[model samples]
Target chain A: MRLRFRPVDTSFYDLFTESAGHLVRGVALLAEMLSDTADHDNVAARMREAEHAADETTHSIVKKVNSTFVTPFDREDIYALGSGLDDIMDSMDEVVDQILVYEVKVLPPELSEQVDVLQRCAELTAAAMPKLQSMKELEEYWIEINRLENQGDKNHRRILAKLFSGEFKAMEVLKLKDIVESLEDAIDGFEKVANIVEQLAVKES
Target chain B: MRLRFRPVDTSFYDLFTESAGHLVRGVALLAEMLSDTADHDNVAARMREAEHAADETTHSIVKKVNSTFVTPFDREDIYALGSGLDDIMDSMDEVVDQILVYEVKVLPPELSEQVDVLQRCAELTAAAMPKLQSMKELEEYWIEINRLENQGDKNHRRILAKLFSGEFKAMEVLKLKDIVESLEDAIDGFEKVANIVEQLAVKES
Candidate 1:
């Protein structure tokens, strides 16, 4: 008879929760960046730091998964969750980078709607990560994210229509459109994260 | 002990191959749409058909994965590969639709370089899908794709430089930049697919 002895590690759940916490901070900075009276230098710097912190957490998760033969969940699920979380941060960081690089002035009021959706998603995701081990109470997290994504989509279409309605100059329209699409991508990225979490819960349950 | 007998379904490889075939046709139509003498309606119709076909194959893969207890590889990997392939096609289709809708008269010469990259990636990806069943001889496919993506990145930077170099009108830069970025996205997506395939191979080997 062969005996197996492997201690299940619960640290991954803690790491995932920590990573999601960075998302909360990242999105808050994103909202600050979108503010009209913002200091762009400080906002960009803070977002950059948040993104780096998120990256480190992702790297830690990947390393732990690679070293441990018996994981808390499937290997690919861990990878997918880590990558999904990292991608959302990347999208948020890109929005801030573009705003700075393009020297975008005259911020759109419509962008606030997308930021609002993002903040809600961050909160939901941060809340959901801690419950991953229990595999309970995650249904609402994903459902709310889906609803929020739909809201972001509607906001995106409205913003695009306004951009093409000739209210702004052609140059401003171009600059604003990139920022708008980045926000949309960030929102969609959050939905991807939520979908992965839902799948993980189903598999674990 | 319980006895288990489940047949391995190989139809997934065929469906994936079929989906990659659509990518080949999709990118080719995208190239045709960029041509100065393109028959826009016919090309759009064909691209739409290609996108629909790809979507159907993706749905089939997901359905099969859901119903079967044993998949050929990780379920998440299958999902990621399917969604990745579909995303590349979607980005290609968006490029065509934007070009047509924007109704820009002049197509930048740099765009042809991007189209060339897309066509090559489509070819490599289609050729690699059949090998998924064995996961043999895949190293070259991903290496070539990574190189091509780097090439695409360079082309993207040059195109952006040209657009903002005061050589183009504000409206023209806006219209063309969107199209260029979509091409870059398609190229990046191919790399993503290749990366997923590499990971799957590593796990399954």
Candidate 2:
């Protein structure tokens, strides 16, 4: 019997999962931030913690890529995936930070719809990260994320219409619009992460 | 006398310059788009062309990196520079598209201030691309971009203050704020490109 070996860096997958885990934590905090009883300051603090964790994971991936002679996937793809995940976290953090900095006490009820889209995207992304090892069973992840992103766009348009319908005060409309746009950016960031993963899978397979 | 043999690929530098050139065109269209006498439709159409050209140059740089045995800079640096330049173009295009899609006439006069920052950043970026081969004389480029970005931040806050100051109607405030944020994003995108260049220069030096 002969034993064959290849230089496999499984740590990349582990760090990816770690990065996705941070997204889950961040989105959960986002949901809390949107809730009626939510404490904005506390939620923002928790979000900062999650964002810092995500950044650490991203740095870890970059360092690994820098030092590893053989990466699990293409080096560029690894870097993109790390950066994509970090972008998602950063955008989500911005949503929380804005909610606090803007001192927006009353969030539009429609904001929940956007937050729901973010939660679903995070859940799907968390589920998809592990399967990156084989690049199998991942098509549905990005497809669902895309569909959710479109749904988010619709929510955004409808919310903007309601905002401009003269119901919201001028200042409230400005605050609400800022929050809504950040939510849209978070959804878009998730789609970008999924797209990168899909591309990586195709390249690896 | 003996000539040293080295694997030098200058096409990457050429592609970077070409990408920066597209940015020059994009910002010019953006400036035109903001003018009171501007034809938004025509300016947007022209912007789409410039954005497409920038994407092609980015792809060319990526292909060159993948195929070449030795890149002029670190592989990661090449990818970062290509991506950073592309991001600036994308953000600029988004600004133009937002104006067209939102039918936002009557841009705040303060927007020109932001546009000036972008124009300076574009010039600095275009100037810096040709010097990537040596990574010399690049400090002032990023420093100047950083200064402009700070100036942009100040302009952004002033514009937001005016937007929320009850001067504009509710809907106008929302629309104007969206446009302002995109302009800021473009400025931030330029700073990001400059930051990447600074890192690349540090690495090569």
lDDT of 1 by residue, A1-205 (tens): 9676887554888988988898899889988988889999899999999999999999999999999989888899899999998999999999999999999878878899999999999998999998988888888999899889978976876676677655789878988998999999999999999879866764554
Give the per-residue lDDT digits (tens) of candidate 2, residues B70-96: 667776677767878888887888788
Off by over 4 Å in 1: A1-105, A119-131, A134-178, A202-205, B1-10, B37-53, B100-103, B136-166, B198-205
Compared with the true structure, what per-residue lDDT tens digits does model 2 show for residues A20-113? 9998899889889989899888889888988898898999999999999988888888998999999989888999999999999888888888
With a 3 Å backbone cut-off (N, CA, C), the pairs that clash in candidate 2 are: none
- Each model's lDDT comes to 0.87, 0.85
Candidate 2: CAPRI quality band: incorrect
Residue B122 lDDT in candidate 1: 90
Q: Which candidate is the best by DockQ?
A: 2
User: How far off is residue B139 in model 1, in Å?
Assistant: 5.2
On lDDT, the candidate that comes out on top is: 1
Assess every candidate by TM-score.
0.67, 0.66
Clashes of each: 0, 0
